[model samples]
Target: MWSTCSLARPPKQHPYENRGCLLNDDVSNLGKVLEATKQTLFSLDTGYVSLNRILCLFEVWKTFEAKSPSGLCVLMLDVAELFNTFDISLANATQPADMERIPREIEENIGSVQLNLRLKDALVTSADHKASNRHGPGKDT
Candidate 1:
C-alpha cells in the first residue's frame, strides 16, 4: 500500500516563482500566440534575406563584373579575412587613404594580389618527402 502526503507549509509566492514548477494546463489553446511568434521569427529571417540580396546587388554594381564570369568568381572569393595576408604598405600606396577606413573602392583595385606560394611549395616538398620515405633506405627487398 502507498500513502500521499500534503505540504506542511504553503509557499509565500506563486508556485511558478519556486525555481522550477510543474503545472498541468492546455497549451494547445496557445495556437494564436505561437502563430504570432512564428510570424515575428519569419519576418526577421526575411529581413536578413532582403539585406543579403541588397548586398549582392551592391557588389555586382561595384565590381562591374556582374555580367562577367570573373565577376562571379571574385564575388565568391569575398570571404572573411580574404586579404588578411595582404601587404599593408602596398595597400596604402595603391589606395592612398587614412590608415583607418581604407575605402572599399581602393580595396577592390589592389593590383597583383599575392598567392600562398610558400604553402604550395611546402605541400610539394611534403609530398616528395613521403614518396622518398616510402622507397626505404638501401633495401632491394
Candidate 2:
C-alpha cells in the first residue's frame, strides 16, 4: 500500500546541496532526511562505534566528496580486547590465564596502543581473572 519510494535517487534538496556546510547551513527538510538517515543507516544504537558504522557514514559522505574528520585511523576490534590496553611488566602484573586466542587478541590490541600505555593495572579488574572459573574466557570457563 505504499505509493512511492525511490532508493536510487535522493530528494531534490539533499544534504549534498550544502556539502561541507552541513552543520552551518540553514536547516530545512534535509534535517528530516538526515534524521531519517541516522535512524536507518547509522548503526548508532550502541556506543561500540564499529568500523562498519563509521565506514557506512563515510560512504555516504564520499558521495558528496565531503571532507573533514580527516586523517582518521579506523580500527576494528573485538569488544573483549577493549577491556584493557596498557603496558605492564609481566613479572609484576596480573594477567588472565590465556585462552585459545584471547591472549593473541590482546597482543594485537597492544600494537594499536603501544605509544600510550605505560601504566600497570590499566585493565586490572576485581575478578580473579588469573585462574578463577567463574565465567568468561577464564580458561574457557
Candidate 3:
C-alpha cells in the first residue's frame, strides 16, 4: 500500500506535476485514467481535437495501410551536408519526373519562356551548383 498519495489540483498552473499518484499494487488504475483521458479528448461533444490525437489516429490507420503499398514513389535524399559539392549545371539541366507536387510545380515554373524577363535574369544570376547524387564517399553499391 502507498504510505501517502497526493492529488495536485488546478492543473494548468502546475501542468507537469498534477498527474495523480497511486499505490504500486493499484497501478492498474493508470490504464483506467488513460482510457478516460482518451474518451474525454476524443468525445465529439467536446468539439476539440489536438494535433497529437490526430497524429495518433493517422498512425493507427497507417499500420493497416502499411501491409499494402500505396504505389506512390518516394525519394528521400540526404545530401544536405554536401552543399558545397553541388553540380549546378546538372541541376539546371535536370528533367524531373513530376510524380510529386513540389517537383511538378518546380518543373512547370523553372524554365518557362513566358516568365517575366527580369525574373528570368534573376533566376540565372542566383543559380547555384547542386552536388551530384553519385560518387559519394561510401563504397559503390
Best candidate, TM-score? 1
List, residue by residue over 1-141, the lDDT tens digit for candidate 3: 111112212223323333422223333243333333211111111211211122222221222122211111112233233233322122221112211322233236432222222222322222321122343466363
Question: Candidate 2's residue-wise lDDT over 1-141, tens digit each?
Answer: 111111112224434443432222222232334333312221212333322221232222221122212211122223244335322222111112212222343346443234123111211221233234456563555
- For model 1, residues 1-141, the per-residue Cα lDDT tens digits are 111111111234434434332222311222223333211111112122211222222222222221221222121212223224422223221111222232343245532221122222322444455457667787443
Candidate no. 2 TM-score = 0.16
RMSD (Å) per prediction: 26.3, 19.0, 24.5
TM-score of predicted structure 1: 0.19
Better model by TM-score, 2 or 3? 2
Question: Against the hidden reference, what TM-scores do the models get?
Answer: 0.19, 0.16, 0.14
For model 1, the local distance difference test gives 0.26
lDDT of 2 at 23: 29
Q: By lDDT, is 1 or 3 better?
A: 1
Superposed model 1: Cα runs more than 4 Å off: 1-115, 138-141
Identify the runs in model 2 with alpha carbons over 4 angstroms from their true place.
1-43, 47-50, 53-65, 70-141
Worst 10 contiguous positions by lDDT, candidate 1? 1-10
